[model samples]
Target chain A: MRCWERPLIEIIRLSVNGDSHEIGVPSHYTLLETLRYVLGLTGSKQGCDKGDCGACTVLLDGLPTLSCILPVQEAIGRQVTTIEGLADPDGPHALQDALDLTGGAQCGFCTPGILMSAAALLNVNSSPTRQEIREALSGNLCRCTGYTKIYEAVELAARALREQRPPAEVLRS
Target chain B: MLRLHPYEYHRPRELEAALELLKEHAGDVMPIAGGTDLVPNMKHRLFAPGHLVALKGLPELHGIVERQGEIVLGAAESLSSLADHHLVRSHLPSLARAAGAIAHPMIRNQATLGGNICLDTRCTYYNQTFFWREALGFCLKKDGDVCHVVRGGTRCVAAHSADTPPILMALGAKVDTASPEGVRSVELDEFFIADGIWNTQRKPDEIVTRLRVPLPSPGLRTSYQKLRERRSVDFPLLSLALAVGLDGDDRVESIALVVAALGAKPRRIGGLETLAKGERLHDELIEEIARQAYRQSNPLDNIIVDIEWRRAMVPVFVRRAIREALARP
Candidate 1:
């Protein structure tokens, strides 16, 4: 019998960000493999094979789960995320635009995880503090991006979100 | 890292069927609740059960209830859920605090309270993958004979390094377990076996169902303290959970001090209670009790972080946990 022929490969149907990834992942394969190999959604980088590195960060059921360590079988029916899910490529988020304009993408290997972390924060609180940004981005490491510009980018995003706030009186009245 | 040898997965919706699977497969079958702990271990090939019994489908294993006066927490309740439970916060506040302190928010969302309680026994020597263990000719906990922790110790010296046990014990909780034989209640304190090779005396067939903590009476106060190398995701080098009460005059009524991540079980320090009862807590008295605790703790080279630092922090955390519990004006 072949390695995957033992009635193996549990059919995993996942809703990744807004897209769907229905793949025949092997029993031993990780969710990272599903993203990188199967569907070619390679935004979730595989930095640390173990759970230590946050590079494989993805939103499983809207929480930042390290996909490299998380089993692919575990993602069945759960929502997954990647940098690809942050925004439409043409319509970049203030966070993404800020990162790009502020040169937060030096080497870019770790930018995806950093963006995912920041995007999760901006999803909840549009206007976050400087300390809050630091706390939120603590898990994602960027060796090339020395975090000064990244911090500035978070500040810029917070400002943009606050300035772009909807008129409360218009909605209410 | 080693690979997880593939095992057939079975998801049974009911508890009885899961137990039946356990009976059929015996040692070869492993039941997974949260998969926060087991899946990582499987990938490491630390203990590869031949059959993987997925317990996520069993609804009976999950839920939180306030029955009568006691808080009944199902085994599948996640750490994040426990941290967020209003009843748990009001009744067993230290448990909530401990649950929140574990790992990080992401891990807490997936790592259940029962998973933390039933976390596989750990040690620096024993936690490595199968191949690493094989290189060392195995240790006492798994496939080998001698304990590397104690050099020639006859038993496995793997520590019961769970953060939740000490807090649960301090809260006066009891657990209900179901088996093919019948159901039985084990006091949270008595549930942990002192032996490491066979860490828990619980029968393999018995599955922990619900943990119940009695309602908090008036004058109850609680606090939890953890000492680790860094703040996030690292297991405690030394942890203490303190829960106590004061009479009308603010005299000590009842006291519990439990230490975790130090030994094979969450060892209750009966000596600390001697200093607590009948006296009004003062800084001098607190310091005296902590000193006694520090001397009593015997840490080995079996865990990460300095054993000396772990031993040193015992009194500090004990003092903090107690002080926080009593926090007088």
Candidate 2:
């Protein structure tokens, strides 16, 4: 048996969605597992636990990262945002409401990851072109193949956010 | 969900400390920059290192600068930043394109240049889950000894599926590394050897610091073309990087074509200067160069793609790459 094969535990600090928490996690745990299992933040879905599917996407220090591949220790001192962080006490995020209203999420298994990816994009480019939206969401895989509606939802959400109106109002417009 | 093997994680604040950790653990510890490659491999049981030394945030390994006629790219710089940087975009657009074309947006945000260049050789047989490989009896790349890609063969033939190394090789780049012993630099051309188990010249204890790409000549035009099933997230089925320097009169002064994703090391097509020098990129000359690329590339069934289909794409992609380069202003 090798020395490194032995399991070890360490206490680490993580900042997620404007909150800070100290938790003990196994040294080998990925951010996705730490979120879903240890911290009970299961909004970051784990799909293709490797780097293939973007279902494990999270916003790390304002950048969308594949949490399944990210070692939890690396998240120290960085802000981690999952799908749960997208909305406040008010309601679902504009993107989420837009996705629901547009019927963009068929299975909902891939929604959390896709929302995180889209949030990262909408944060930077509030008014993204269709091509830019497609490029940004390319990492995420939605098996339902409802990309047309998903793209439409993103377009609709962008207009609502830019106009400072609800996605429902923007959808009607 | 695939689980990572039990291990210890070390995050060193200094490069010296990181090197010391790597030296102390030696073969037991693996340096993890992006974790975009190593993490998945670990989950797949391709690697089970006892310890991982994080190199993502070392100050010494982060930055991009134009230094003395070269573009110095910090090994830890993310692919997203590198692809979007003005210096890389204006000076080495092909490299920028290649960097942008890697994986996808979320991955580019985390993956680094060093990780991409040092990416592991991949194969359908080797990249599978542990049970999948065990049911078939493992191949030469991992626990088993027999070579499944080339049955009865003694060597491992996993494909080098990186998008940027071939471009860096064509651009005459140099790799810089640091260790407890000190720092060392090597030409990117000699950095890779013909072995799929571990292909790079980097020692186990050394950490890649940065890459220095000599600035392109005024008339030099370079382009990269990738053949993947999808536009995002898929590794290259076939990738080609072409660079041609033309005299003021539009006559070829020098040319280089490097094709990858076929073998352990990216194959640089030879005799290109002999055939292309002092000639215009006419239909005949282009066809001849494409033929040279076709003759040199022999893609196997390492990837699930058809071997013959991948081989047929060598010339087609080469011609398209040349046309793309020629079209660039």
Top DockQ prediction, candidate number: 2
- Kindly list the per-residue Cα lDDT of model 1 for residues A62-106, writing each as its tens digit: 777777766677778777878888877657777777787777788
Complex DockQ, candidate 2:
0.82
lDDT of 2 at A28: 90
Task: Label model 1 with its docking quality class.
Answer: acceptable
Summarize candidate 1's per-residue lDDT along B184-277 as a digit string, tens digits: 9989999998777656657766778888888877887788998876576677788888878778888888887888788888888777566778
Q: Model 2 segments beyond 4 Å from truth?
A: A1-6
The root-mean-square deviation over C-alpha atoms between each candidate and the true structure, in angstroms, is 4.1, 1.1
- Quote each prediction's TM-score: 0.90, 0.98
lDDT against the true structure, each candidate? 0.77, 0.93
Error of 2 at A28 (Å): 0.7
Error of 1 at B33 (Å): 1.9
Tens digits of lDDT, candidate 2, B1-329: 89999898989999989999999988788999999999999999988889899998799999899999999999999999999999999999999999999999989999999999899999999999999999988999999988888979888899999999999999999999998899999998899999988999988888899999998999999999999999999999999999899999999998989999999999999999999899999999999999999999988889998989899999999889889899999
C-alpha positional error of residue A146 in candidate 2 after TM-score superposition, expressed in Å: 0.8
